[model samples]
Target: MTGSVTLVEVGPRDGLQACKHPIATAARIGLIERLRKAGVKRMEVGSFVSPKHVPRMADTGEVMDAVGSRAEPGDMVLIANARGLEQVIAHGARTIAVFTAASDAFAQKNIGCTIAASLERFAPLVETARAAGVAVRGYISTITDCPYSGEVAPEAVVPVARSLMEMGCGEISLGETLGRATPCRIAAVIEAVAAHVPIEALAAHFHDTYGMGVANVWEAVRLGVRTVDAAVGGLGGCPFAPGATGNVASEDIVYLLHGQGIETGIDLDGLLDAAAYCGDTMGIAPVSRVFKARRG
Candidate 1:
């Protein structure tokens, strides 16, 4: 609908964070490296969450070391708090994303903190990062539905988004973490958030659980959102979101956008190859409908 959008690849972070089995550190780094070679300028390389709670991301430090030393411009991590920020500082991470859910219950369950507490903790991290010449990003989870809290109101998402910006996050990513958001619901949340947060500073993170991720992406684009978060080979799921699917596939987003004459600056063939490779390394098949249909 407008200029090019920044598609932030989240395969290495959200994609791997929810997996039950831990992928080899080398394989995980391989995924990030391949994505970089495929011309993905921005990525959520990994997270600094507790390894015991999420064994899949246990190799956080190692993965950071691997991706950090080789990171090109614009690569980053989904940090949890000030400690996480500190951990990635040595990796030379300039862009860090702090996440919170729109539903209070989900926030408590996910991070053991109330919504306000989570934001309060992140405020200092954001200040410290910005003071030291780093950029901060924010993620608002459960924009549509929450497993623990059921349906989430569009109004509920706005204040959190606003709060995150007040905390100094450069952008706010609205996540349909449970994958229950339809195009209409997505538009509703966007409309609500627009009243309080500028559309230009907003992004969408949709999952394909009900085959609506792409459609939701179209809705987001129509609403003037310039950033969209995706993952390769559809490789992520949320532990708290029932029937949650992996993220909207990067290859699919790239294909649809490029076909529509939008410039995403990604190499389609290279993206496909990287998706296939990551799938292979993770011992899974590519779940993107576009990826499978194209091969046929």
Candidate 2:
């Protein structure tokens, strides 16, 4: 039997968060419902960040209520700090994500705090999640190269991963925030962090700026990583990271894994439909080459 792989759909949250035009709350909820129907077991519904900072996600609570009301089992949210966690928990979110960066400059520019300070602030939120019996996931951005800092050391990813694990995060997702990571560099970071954390406890989030997301993902899986974070229709990018591309497309990743004889328990055709639905609803051409190619 092929080993299990979990695809965490970040479209509703990450995809919509960066969109300039305001997508209606109803449409956002519809997107999540469609994704769930496509066999996505894990979906990030929204973030609890300040609406002032991410006006796109200003309807966080409303989105949570709409999706959370019908959430199957593992639907989740991204909590940037304690306040965000509080809002999500109140909305009955079962899983929450705390984010930091492997590069200090990246973290500072993204969240206006130093790396250490960002980790410190997340500690209390992790503790709270543990107490509430909610699963905690950690996000470490710029694991490879940061647009602002240039080449980042692989070793830098370890401490952030370790800190999240120590703070009770069940899993840590290393993000190629600028989409500049190559397979070799991804392997190097994995090697450095696998010593401090179980490979199974690690997840990967890659962007396709250089068109290396799938290659990097294959590298991560070969090294024993299972969970991967992807967006439907390839609909997300880092606002703070210059020239960053959309994440690896969900349908494309599913297709790649299926071709490898890996059973993701996801319906690729259904997911492709979801990708199309998102593309139509958002009125933007999907960035997924797979979706475009198949449609053509």
Clashing pairs in 1: none
lDDT per residue (tens digit) for residues 12-78 in model 2: 8887788878888888888888888889999888898878878888887898787763344587789
| Number of clashes recorded per candidate | 0, 0
Candidate 1 runs further than 4 Å off: 69-71
Candidate 2 lDDT at 70 equals 34
Lowest summed-lDDT stretch of 10 residues in model 1? 64-73
Candidate 1 structure lDDT: 0.85
- Which lDDT value does model 2 have at 280? 76
The weakest ten consecutive residues by lDDT in model 2 span 64-73
Provide the overall lDDT of each model, using Cα atoms, as 2-decimal numbers. 0.85, 0.87
For model 1, how does the per-residue alpha-carbon lDDT over 1-296 read when each residue is reduced to its tens digit? 54697899998889878887668999988888888888899998888777777778767778767776335558777778767778878777778888899999999988889899999989888999999777888999989898887899999998899999887888999999977778999999999998888889998899999899988998898888888999988888887667898999998998888877778999977888887886678886778877797752
| Best-fitting candidate, scored by TM-score | 2
My TM-score estimates for the predictions, one after another, are 0.95, 0.97
Task: Identify the candidate with maximal lDDT.
Answer: 2
Give the C-alpha miss distance for residue 296 in model 1, angstroms: 6.3
